[model samples]
Target: MAGGLVAGYVLGKLYLLLANRLRDHTVSIVMQFVATFLVWILGEQLGLSPIITVVVYALTIARVLPLRGEAWLRVQRYAVWDVVILVLNVLAFVLIGLQLRLSLPQLEGPNGRI
Candidate 1:
C-alpha cells in the first residue's frame, strides 16, 4: 500500500508533466489513456492495488489542476469518453450477470452457501 501510494503520486506527476509538454490535444488525450493503463499495470506488477493506483492518479489530476483546451476539442473528448464509459459500464454489468447465471445452478436449494 505504501508503495502503491508513492508510485501513484509519481505516476500522477509524470502524467501532468507529459500533458504539459504535449502540443496536440488528440495526442495528449490518447497519452493520458495510455498512461492510465501503464500506471495500473505497473502498480499490479509491483504488488500494489491497481484500482487504488488508478483512482489516486485520477483524483490527483482532477483535484490538482485542470487542463484547458479548445472548446471543440473539449466537446470531442467528452463525446468520445462518454461512449467509452457507457460501453465499459454495460460490459461490466453484463459480465456480472453472466457470472451469477453460471454459478446459480451450482447453488443448492435454501441456505446453500454461495
Candidate 2:
C-alpha cells in the first residue's frame, strides 16, 4: 500500500508534466482519465490499496494543475472531476446500504445475538 501510494504520487507528477506538453484539449483530458485508471489498476495489481493510491494521485495532480495557469483547462477539469466525485460518493453510499441490507439477516441469525 505504501509503495503504491508513493508510486501514485510520482505518477501524478508525471501526468501533470505530460499534460503541460499536450496542445489538444480532448487528448489531454483523455490522458488524465487514462492515467487515473492506470494508477488505480496498477496499484491494485501490485496488492496495494487502490483507493489510497487514487486519492494520493488526485491530490498531487490537483495541487500542481492550478499552478500552470491554464484557466480553461482548470475550469473544465474541475467541473468534470467534481461531478465524478459526487457520483462516486452517491454510489458508494448506495452500495454500502445494499451491503448492510444483505448482511443484516445473517447478523440476526435466529436470535439476533449479533
* Full-model lDDT for every candidate: 0.81, 0.85
lDDT of 1 by residue, 6-97 (tens): 88888898788777677787896787688989999999998999988888888877665355456676677678779889999999999999
- Best-performing candidate as measured by lDDT: 2
Candidate 1 Cα RMSD (Å): 3.0
- Ten-residue segment with the worst summed lDDT in candidate 1? 62-71
The residue-level lDDT of candidate 2 at 90 comes to 100
C-alpha RMSD of each candidate structure in angstroms:
3.0, 3.0
Q: Candidate 2, residues 72-95: lDDT per residue as tens digits?
A: 987887788799899999999999
True lDDT of residue 103, candidate 2: 91
Note the residue pairs that clash in candidate 2: none
